[model samples]
Target: MVEGKGEAYLLIDVGHVLTHAAYIARVEGTARLAAVAEVTTTTAAEGGLLDGVRRATANLELLVGRQILDRAGEVRQPRDGDGHGVDGVVVTASLAPLLRVALVGLTCDFSLASAVRAATLPYVSLERTVSLEGPGDAWDAEDLEALVQEPPEVLVIVGGADGGPVAPIREMGETLSTAYSLLAASQRPAVVFAGNERACRPLEATFAGVVEVSAVANVRPSPEKENLGGLQGELAHLFYKRLGRSEGLRQLGTWAGSALRHDLDALARTLRFVACRHGLARGVLGVDAGGNGCRVLWVRPRGPALNWAAPFGLGSGLGALRQRRDPTAVVRWMCHPISWAEAWDRLSNIEVRPGGVPETEEDWDLQQAALREALGATWQGAVRAWAGYAEGQAVGEADMIVARGTSFTHARTPGQAALMLLDALQPTGLVRLALDWANLLPGLSGLAERDAQAAVQVYDNDALLELGTLVAPRGVLRPGSRALRVRLTVAGEERAELDVPAGSIRRLPLGVNERGRLELYPARGLDVGLGRRGRGGVVEVRGGALGIIIDARGRPLGLPKDEEARRAALEAWQREIEQA
Candidate 1:
């Protein structure tokens, strides 16, 4: 009757709970997963909420037997499902689709990159980033056309972290004022200045007549370190506007609960949680490749992409598509086989239900391809929209694949859909075998609700229809370099020689936690910051089904070309060799 040992535990992510996996374990054998459900509690309240969780439990008897039911028959099993028959319910207090944002920056350096990186995350969708450089660092009056034409939904004005260097930031302020002034009254933009707080008021008043302006703490308060964490929340607030108003997403938001943080945003927050639980960034990189985007993360005390542009993400140019109506150039990755007509229909459907699944494989394939067209077109269009100013300089396919668009419900397998993105953006060899979120929209929109961890767990263990994590790290990879051969090794096992292209990933074992940490190889550097341990050397990278990587991007990680070098590299990792 106990089903084995420990009582059943169900994580009732009252808010958008995607991957909240329920495990039943004793002080003995492995705690096997009893259920994994993706729940969305967007607009629902108390009663409606509890009912949702109850429905999620396929084991009805488990609930009745545990007396999780209350007076009016409400679920009170410790909202998080800590243990069966344990009076407490793991009712998480989370929300989704909080706000929409816009960014204004002085330059495209670390400051702006910080803003962009922040926007690329799960909780936020950077509406727009305003810069003085127009599109390039040397744009003329004509190049400023895009800034004038289509300003931004919100602006994150960033500069030299602190206010030390004022020239570039001031010029950017003037540029922002000028651009804001041009937009039609109804099309007025919003500005979130993260640069020198000293100048934000002036920029705010200067452009007050043009758009709504709000300012947050400087992302780069000082050059020695970068702070994009706050800005990430600010952007989530901005994106909330879009989520709240949209009928479809809004309804789903209700399921995810109020204030939704993007999947990436949730990951960022959880990263901190895991870090506090674990400690330090050895060589860690976390990736979440969803339908509309790709979020690559590595937690450090320095500058993260959220506060600036390290040229991160696979959906790099997706925002640029806001300028074009027919974004066909970049949406080619969804990879469904559909006709132009059906594609249009799917695109139309996607406008409202971005993750709608196609009933038939033919329809599914067509819609997926259409998704590529739509999102890709968005990427190209976003750049092209800016093309009015930055012209050819706009990062088309070059930006780290930051944004992606997909409707994954129709997916029959995990690798089938997500793997395409790995092939498209071509994750850097230094970091391979990232995650791909499907059907579980809450994972992307769970941050605002504070239910990210539960959501991530639900998706990783439950919605992961496909049970593989670290797919091999092969295919194309790039980070301003054209080198093939990534220095990948499994537990230092005779370092495997892989040849990834500019955009692709090899597969490996999936990881959950101690219960989820799939042990195939020793450790492929997928742990927290590349698995840095004190004597043990087990980098605690949390919540990835995919395996580890040996990235060589900016680090220029070595690759043994000749026999001697290969032997040397292998020897270097020989200490932590993978189990035979």
Candidate 2:
């Protein structure tokens, strides 16, 4: 960037596992951050983090900017190389040799799977996956033998994070330590631990010099929470550092540029952006709730945000919610005539307590109670506890509330806030929007990251929602029926329209990083993507235990239930992949 008359900036973010300091350069129209050297922090004080980072920069010192976290976002613009002592907190990048990797995970759901996705993302050559159904103690000498059968380039570890990735930390540590001791010193596989942040330090000390070691943040911070932006970026950086030796990145790194985004934070920001930018009112609420915690952000016209990341998630806090009493009492949209027994069973199934499922109605009742307890107890409680922490200036009443998390994500794709709205059931005006699909404003935001033109390419009115006029009054009331048509024209040529219904969902054919405007259909069973019932794009429905009204709008929807149908749907989506 020094060549582009630009600047190099470094960002340090401290999460559960790793503290990453990215060396980024921005000059003229170029930006790139070395993908390699993403290191995991084991020690709380990180005695060597800053030194290591500064040393790595020597190979390429044109870097002009430095960024680091002070736990609460301290460290503002410090002088280069001189920052080591300025703040007692600094981190450097660590490089491990080669590229062999073992994906150790707790569950195959979000966190573990997200980790695997991140590893495979850079298209890194993977070695194996290590899984433990129970505690790491369950894995004996034979297990260790299997993990070390061949000297892996890196050992990427992950497991249950809801309760903290600790139990297996000690067990996995002992096992990996044994493996490390047995391996030849020079050929020892470097350990790149990216699981429970709590395990990094102990594991590092346990296998000191036993093997090459580094750590990253938890792949999936919480069950429903995914910090893939950090994981994938760091993984790529590490991959480039070790495997590419700078050769792999070349033009790619230059193209990728130096600026980066924290995946969770970016996603939250994107959703908030969607709430404000896409809508006409200039105010939107987007929240992501998971097993461990929830992230809530409110965006209104002309200002900062009312945003925060809560360390409490629905699943992790279910037990706590029960203690608070009545999860449904406050949530009114759930008036689907669900019995206490039914609600209990639903919660029980979701909790997936190590070894149990509801068998009897009483068990079901217990489960519902647990679910209520869990939902009410957690980060949602944090919402009440930390009310308006995310509120910003120029904010009146919340225009629309967008939320996604395990509790919300698992319940309904786009149903959360709607459900809340329904429960709140104001007898007057109501605001409508597309708050479905894992709350993926970040997916669009990612478009901005991956390609600015593409980001602008997808940013049309329909691609975004311009808040319609509504004066909401407090009182529960379900509307009868209404329809509206929205046409989103981009660059005065390409256009996407939503024949959206006031009370129904219509799925659209999504092309890579593309956005569409939603307009209501004049008739039912009409195709939106294909335009005018051309047998191409029509709203499809797959009802879940969550909501019934079926209101959503997005392209390339998430996973399916039926095996054959899901397979066929996936095959069909290949078209979108090709189209994208």
Candidate 3:
């Protein structure tokens, strides 16, 4: 175990399909990533999660030219005098089943909404919701019996203002107690009470000895005030408790001690830190499209970060994505012609073999299409949730967007990833795009808690792959008309100039890390996030893999109704990005 602060740290991400490990050490006064390795995740039936972690660690040791594991195959902690071990170990994971949760609340609009928002973690599955808002406030006999039959892992009881009515909450507590009494001890669900403070003691007494009861701050303290942080914290704590039940996780947790974190939680923390660390005026937006879930996190400088999760992604969640959206929706983004049955067959094949790589062009296109739809669905939910708390600025007004998970990281090319991001998020204004190519955000988050300087240095230097800056205007324009004029100057010399037409995308040649100046002049009706229409200015820009992308597709990016035209447009856009 690490005695105190350690210069060399080992970080691991135990994902559902893949496990990744990275070694970071202080080199010449700066934290530098020394090595990274990944291996297929091992299921519990295949000797538990540690098998995959050990394999990845072994690979990392080979790359770093040091032994991270001892003869016992356990991670050697508190670096040895001969440089045989790491000083600290940190782990983040998304390898467990979703936490089954039931929401019991007073009203649909206030407490219930807040509870839903709080439960928006990738590993949380809200199984049931019982709202006590109607005139017939008493619990139905059928409802109580259902709770007894298939009890959720957690019952989040939230309602009533801080000083408001307590009798209703107490009544609900009694109903829950009666249901808990009917179930076996092992079947009873833990209760989290986030209701009126006045009802806390009564609820505790109601469920005493019957089940675990944790009382947090009221979710809706007043009609105008909603505080969800305390409740979110409680839910996360419960999730960790449940995760500890796994033998592999428990062992890893022992080694990590206080440094272990849930993957989604860590990602959220990292985004918030990045936003605040950079003092971003617009904020940071992040999306993680994993094998089994998709998450969108929006973190501004000074407000509560908004998080949204959907239990659908590129791999195991592909089938769920088909059920969630129309089958045609996934087919719409395809650049090549495909029949409905063929598309359905491909999606089914992926559901059965989620970890399998795409072997054909059609399969690749289909996966990208599904990814776009999945991210779009998650982004819409985030927007709706943010609408209530958004202060003046629009939800899409982010200065930097970081894409994570295999959907972006494993794309065939950086250009493909950038196009998918632009199509999925459809952000407006001038924004910087990046990819968590190494899946290092979670580890960096844990590292930051222990070594802030090291985490910052590593994050700035190695964590993300800059995809360059994007300029997407927001307004309607005539097709083929000049939408914006751009002049690019690199190192005080004019490099390129072009006129961007409406309904088209253009890529400028600017190599990575190359500093440049861009001058934008918008059309009469277009607004590039400036104060007014046709208002534009020059901004200092940094280059990335895709360089400068001018997306003149307009806001709420629309596609042609005809399938042929749509395919043509998608193909054209792909070529535009690829050929750059």
- Candidate with best TM-score: 3
Residue-by-residue lDDT tens digits, candidate 1, 228-332:
767766666666665567554444335323333344444455444433333433323343333333334444323332311211122222332323445333233
lDDT of each: 0.41, 0.42, 0.84
Pairs that collide in candidate 3 are: none
Which runs in model 3 stand beyond 4 Å of their true positions?
A: 1-3, 98-152, 158-166, 183-187, 217-233, 255-259, 490-492
Better of 1 and 3 by TM-score: 3
| 346: Cα error in model 1, Å | 9.6
Ten residues in sequence with the least summed lDDT for candidate 2: 85-94
Ranking by lDDT: 3, 2, 1
The worst-scoring run of ten residues by lDDT in candidate 1 lies at 307-316
Error of 3 at 240 (Å): 1.2
Off by over 4 Å in 1: 1-32, 37-120, 126-130, 133-149, 159-187, 200-216, 220-233, 236-260, 268-580
TM of each candidate vs. truth: 0.48, 0.33, 0.89
Q: For residues 1-580, what per-residue lDDT tens digits would candidate 3 score against the true structure? A: 3345677888999887788999998898898898888888888798788888889999998898889888888878778887788877879987766688999887889989888777766457777887877778767566666677889998999989987777888888887897688778988888899878988998888888898689999888888988888888887888888888878888767754444578877887888888888777788998888888788877777655667778778778777787864757788899889877788787887776676778889888999998899898888877876676666888657999999887788899999999999999999988989999988998898888778888999998999899999999999798799999999999889999999999998988788788799999999899997788999999888789989999998887999899889998999899888765
> Once model 2 is optimally superposed onto the true structure by TM-score, how far is the C-alpha of residue 392 displaced, in angstroms?
10
Model 3 residue 328 distance off true place after TM-score fit, in angstroms: 2.1
